[model samples]
Target: MSFFKAIRIDQRAETCDARYVDMAEEELMPGDVDLAVTHSAINYKDGLAVTGKGAVVRRFPMIPGVDLAGRVTRSTHPDFSAGDLVVATGCGVGEAHYGGFAERARLSGDWLVKLPGTLTPARAMTVGTAGLTAMFCLLALERHGLAPTDGPAVVSGASGGVGSFAVALLAAAGWRVAAITGHPAEADYLTSLGAAEILAREAFAQPGKPLQSQRFAAGVDTVGGVTLANILAQTQFDGAVAATGNVGGMDLPASVAPFILRGVALLGVESVRPRIALRRAAWARIATDLDAALIDAMCEVIPFDQALERARAIVTGKIRGRVVIEMP
Candidate 1:
């Protein structure tokens, strides 16, 4: 096809809106590897970029998908070539770049990774940014000496994309996992992802003490702001919490007691633009660590044109798990 379907976000004055449109291959930004993008996924960041929920898309008339998977159809970079399957996430994708919301993608070779043998393009997008960030959180905690035998790990926002993967990955690594979600009604869903216990969102949503009676040995917090503060307050001696997202709020209402009194370490997980070595290691871990069946249960596939609707739903906390997009 000389022209392909894509979601294009156009800016009018200060406002931005996205629509499905036909895009010519020449319109794509200059890059080394041109791909027939078969799949992409909606991240919280994606929701913001597509719906203008936040200032996520710095440029107008952009393609705003943070994660994509497909096969190379053309190339110049030494690492990737024609017919090789690949996945690309972060590295300013869908933000600083044209990104993955199109049937075609011309991306820098440095931004692409050959798709792992075990995962299809669709399945890789199902994992996408959420799964990668989840893996980063796990690695940070492990680096801080967290172990399955230390104590149970608590995952906040546990039903969302990153949290769901956190629960599944930690559980698979033999860690006792306690899931915290606003949708307590989906207890069985969380349990099915290997959570040993389901905790109420209210437990962490409200204001909390600076230092509380400890319960968790470690934490993977997707919700920031107060939720993160509370988790730090409740973490055990020498425990670590890998903080990834800020859906709750960016303001960190925390105290130094957790650090000074208990020696609790708060490790920050920076998924986008992570070192190439770490990205390779993390994806390899995901290929083996994340259960395929669990991913099947956790993802909700939506059409490429539904990007705007799904983006709105995600930011409003109306959707669950990963939102994978089937590229046209």
Candidate 2:
């Protein structure tokens, strides 16, 4: 087709507006490889962009989707070829670029990762950027020499997409996972994902001491601010915490005692710009490390038209796991 369906976000005055529109192939951003996007997924950053709640969309009149899985229809890049399945996340998609909300995508071949043999396009989107990030956190802890034998692991914001995947990935890797959530009612859901303990969010809501009791060996913290501060304070000596999202707040109301005294490490995960090799390695591991059944269970697939509505739920913390978008 000369034109494809896409969700376009444009700024009208001070407000941001997102709508479904027909976009010509010429309107796609410049790139060497062209793909017929079969699937995409929502992320917290996407929610902010779609709803205009945060400064996620740097360019106006842009398509907004951070993750996509599809097949190459044309390519000049050596690493990809026509009819090859591929997946892409981050690298500025949904922000400065046209992104994958469209039925077609023209993206840098460097930004694409060939889908692992075990992962289907739809399943890849189920894992999406959130799951990739979750795996990155685990890899960080592994590089730091922390193992399941180290001690119990804790994940803050356990009900969200990244946090939920973190819980499952950690558990599957044999870590004793303690999930921390604001929604007390999701305890059962968290447990089903392999959490060994369920902690209330209130426990970390307030400002905590510079160094508190060593309750966790390592942590995957999605919520920043007081929650991250508390996780750092409570981490065991020589333990590390990989932090990604800042949904709680950007300001870190914390002290250096955890680092100086306990030797705790705070690893900042940036999924948007990871090295291509690392991205490939992480995706490869995810395909094997995680059970396909669990991955299927962790996401809810929706039609492309419902993307914005789901985006609102994600930003407001109403989504339980991942939200996969099926392209029409």
Candidate 3:
């Protein structure tokens, strides 16, 4: 196709504007694989980029969807050929390069991963970046020698996309989960995703003692700041906490007691530029471990036109689960 529809964000002197427009194939950045994009997902970062809230968009005239899944229409890459089903997430797309918020995309072969046999394009985007990040946290904990017999695993921000997947993945692996959330009304929903206990966010939002009672064996921390600090303090000896987000705040405001005295490890999980091997491993685990029924339960499919509206909702904490944008 010569021209395709896309959501373009143009940076101005004072602010940036996002709108839908028809873009030429020449406007796409250089890459070896050309894809007819079928599905994209709205993660919190996408919301920030589309609404011009956070500093997520590093380039002007960007397409602001961080995750995309589609069939390859053409490829010069050795690992892939025409008609291959591929998915890409994180690699500075939606930030420094044109991304998935379009009917088509030209992306580097290195950034693309063939979808696991068990996952369809729509189901794959439902997992998207958030679920992938959650899986990374699980992998980190596993590498730290953690097991279900240690103690209950705690997940902060447990109602959101990452948090929801964290709870489900941990529980599926045999660990009882305590899901921490500010929205008590979602307790039942969280429980449905395999959360054994639902704790209020206030308990962890405030600063606590340097080393509190060890209630958890491990944690997947999605809300940084004091929440992470408290999670660290309450973790069992030799336990680990995987931190990935900074929605609460960037400051730690924590003590070294958890690290030095308890031998607790604070593992940092970054999905933006992970090696292809790691990405494949994570998706492989997802294929065998994650429940397809749970995936469907957590997904809301929307048409392309509603993406901007959903983007706003996600950043403001109004979205409960994952949202998939179906391309026209």
Winning candidate number (lDDT): 3
Candidate 3 C-alpha lDDT tens digits along 1-328: 6999999999888788888999999899999999999999998899899888899988788999999999999999999999889999999988988998999999999999999889989999999998899999999999999999999999999988889999999999999999999999999999998999999999998889999999999999999999999999999999999999898999999989999999999999999994899999999998889989989988999999999888878888788688999999
Q: Model 1 off-target regions past 4 Å?
A: none
> Residue 254, candidate 1: how far off, in angstroms?
2.2
Q: What would the per-residue lDDT of candidate 2 be over residues 1-328, giving only the tens digit for each residue?
A: 4999999999999999898899899989999999999999988788899889989998888999999999999999999999999999999988998887889999999999999999999899999988899999999999999999989999999988889999999999999999999888999889998999999999999998999999999999999999999999999999999999897999999998999999999999879894899999999999998899988888789999898789778888777677889998
| lDDT string, candidate 1, 1-328, tens digits | 4898888899987778788888999999889999999999888888788778788887777998989998899999999889999999998888878888889999998888887799888889899988899999999999998898989999999988889899999998999999999986878988998999999999899888999999999999999999999999999999999999998999999999999999999999988894877888888899988778877877788887787788778888787677888876
> Which model, 1 or 2, shows the larger lDDT?
2
What TM-score against the true fold does each predicted structure earn?
0.94, 0.95, 0.96
Query: lDDT scores for all predictions?
Result: 0.89, 0.92, 0.93
Ten contiguous residues with the weakest lDDT in model 3: 312-321
TM-score of 2: 0.95
In Å, residue 235's CA in model 3 sits off its true spot by 1.0
Q: What is residue 14's positional error in candidate 1, in angstroms? A: 3.1
Worst 10 residues of 2 by lDDT: 313-322
> What TM value does model 3 have?
0.96
